[model samples]
Target: MPPVQTVATIRRITPVGAYHHLVLDAPGVTGVRPGHFGALAIGGRDASTLLRRAFSIHRADPGTGTLEFVFAEAGRGTRALAAHRPGDTVDLIAPLGTPFPLPDGPVGAVLVAGGYGSAPMFALAEEILGRGGRVAFVLGAATEDRLFGVERAEALAEHVYVVTDDGSAGRRGRVTDVLPEAVTVTGATEVHSCGPMGMLKAVTEIATAAGAASHTAVEEAMACGIGICMSCVLPVTGPDGVTHFLRSCTSGPVFDGTSVRWDDAGTLPDDLEGAAAMTPKASHR
Candidate 1:
């Protein structure tokens, strides 16, 4: 279904660790799926902040017409959004981006997350479990306070592994440290991850090494949240063995881990498709 531009009333805003959990009564926003995101207009109508902020859909309840978003106050826009009170309305365009692809048949899967990236995993996990698949979680953060959903993961998944950079949580390392063991223990044949790009690359590598398929939801910066702006483009390898810059906001936020050109992320590869066409011809001597 096509996305809808609507005003969502703030149901509540609760502080969760180093993030804010926002619940909105969004009536017209429907067809939400795990890994889908929403673009929220911030700073009121006439404010100078024209670009909307994009966030992953943490949870969506179709019956109640409610949507949940988890975000950190990383800048002025997010800080202003967190300051909103209950009953306040915010302009929203929701259920955007490609969602995580579920397995065709029940299978063991491992979900990996960093910081509040764990937000969408619970809903994904529920969907997986309902389909007779087994779930395992490997959550990590800089510190214990930065971790998002340990309790919820434990309550849902068959196994849960926690890691923190400062040793303030379960294991004293990145989520990749314990992921191999988690995959082995759960016999997971697939791995799904959401977090920093560096972490996603490592997770993809590990899952590949273990003979498991990897699906990653990238956290690339999206200036427009829609396909209009070319700001959020990234190098992605097409099936034809050529690299093309694809817009993260429209083409994907979730992509097959193996398809992303991780090594050439920030820099445009010299051999990328259309690279020669974009180069300026040598000036006449």
Candidate 2:
């Protein structure tokens, strides 16, 4: 289905350390899946900010017609968004991009997240639990305050592992440092991850080594949010065993971990299967 532009009323905004969690009342909006994102136009329609800022859907309550998203003050766009008050109306283009695929039957799965990348995992955990499947989580960040959902994960997941880089939280290490052990302890058959590209790559390697199926929601800077601009492209192995540039905003944000060509992600290598055939034509004299 095509995306819809809706005027959503801001319910409230809560500050969690350096991040702002915004909840909006979006009635008539439905079918929002975990890992889907929203492109919100901040600073009002007549304000200086023209482009919409994209954020992963943190949580959505269909019954209440409310949607939640979190963001840190990265730049002008986000700072403008933070200045908004309750009762303010924000334009939203929501439930965009592909969602994390579900397993065929109930199976133990491990979810790994870094920083605010954990935004989408909670809703996903709820879905998995509803289907009689069990879920475990590994949450990591640079500091204790950056870890957003540890307490919630502790309550929901069968097991929760927290890690921080500065030794200010959980184990003083990366998620990869403890991922293998978590997979083994939970007897996980699948691993789903959303974080930095490097972290996702590491998780893919670890999960593969453990003989577990891995899926990941990639983080790519997007301009159009939808796929028209072709700004967010990544190399992915096609079904025909050839590498192709897939749009992250449309073809995915979620893809099979094994199908991604991580090393050649941003570049088209000469040895790539279809690289030669896709060469550009010379300019006319």
Candidate 3:
């Protein structure tokens, strides 16, 4: 189903370390799945920050008609959003983008997250477990405070590994450092991750090396949240063995890790589809 734009009232905002957990009464929005995101209008209807900020949906409770997402005060838009009080209404277009694909049958899977990227994994883990699958979590961040959802992950996953760069948490290293062990211990056949591009790339490589398929929710800038704006295009190789710039907001947010052109992220590759046409032909000498 297509997404709906609704004026969702702020239920409450809870401070979670360096992030804010926002809950909204959005009855109009439904069928939210893990990896889906919501685009919220910041400030007010006529505020200067015209662009809607995209946030991955943390949890959606259709029974309560409430939706949850987490964010940090990174800039003007997020700062304004952080200032919203309970009962205030914010325009939201939600349940957007492709969601993480669940395994058809019961299977062991490893979930990896970095920083607030842990927001979406709990729900995904729950669904995975509901299907009789086993889940192991490897959560990492720069510090302990930046890590989110440790308690919830522990409650749901069979094993939860926490790591921080400053040694403020379980281990002082990246998630990749503990990922192989997590997969090995859980006997996970699939690896799912959401985090910074570099982290996702590393996780994908590690998962592949461990003989597990990887699914990644890329953290790309989505200026519009919708596909209209070409801002969040990334090079992705399709099944036909052709590289095309796919929109993260539409074609994905979740994609097979092996399909992404991780090495050529920031720039268009010369071999990308239409690249030859876009490049200027050698001038007649």
TM-score leaderboard ranking? 1, 3, 2
- TM-score list, all predictions: 0.98, 0.94, 0.97
Q: Check candidate 1 and list the clashing pairs.
A: none
Model 1 regions more than 4 Å off: none
**Candidate 2: tens digits of C-alpha lDDT, residues 25-123:** 997578888889999988776888877888999998988999999898989999988989999999999889999987667888899999999999999
Query: What does candidate 1's lDDT look like per residue over 119-199, in tens digits?
Result: 899999998898899999999999998999899999997689999999998989999999999999988899999999999
Positional deviation of residue 35's Cα in model 3 after best superposition, in angstroms:
0.7
Candidate 2 worst ten-residue window by lDDT = 265-274
CA lDDT of every candidate: 0.93, 0.89, 0.94
The C-alpha stretches of model 2 lying farther than 4 A from their native spots are 271-285
Best by TM-score: 1
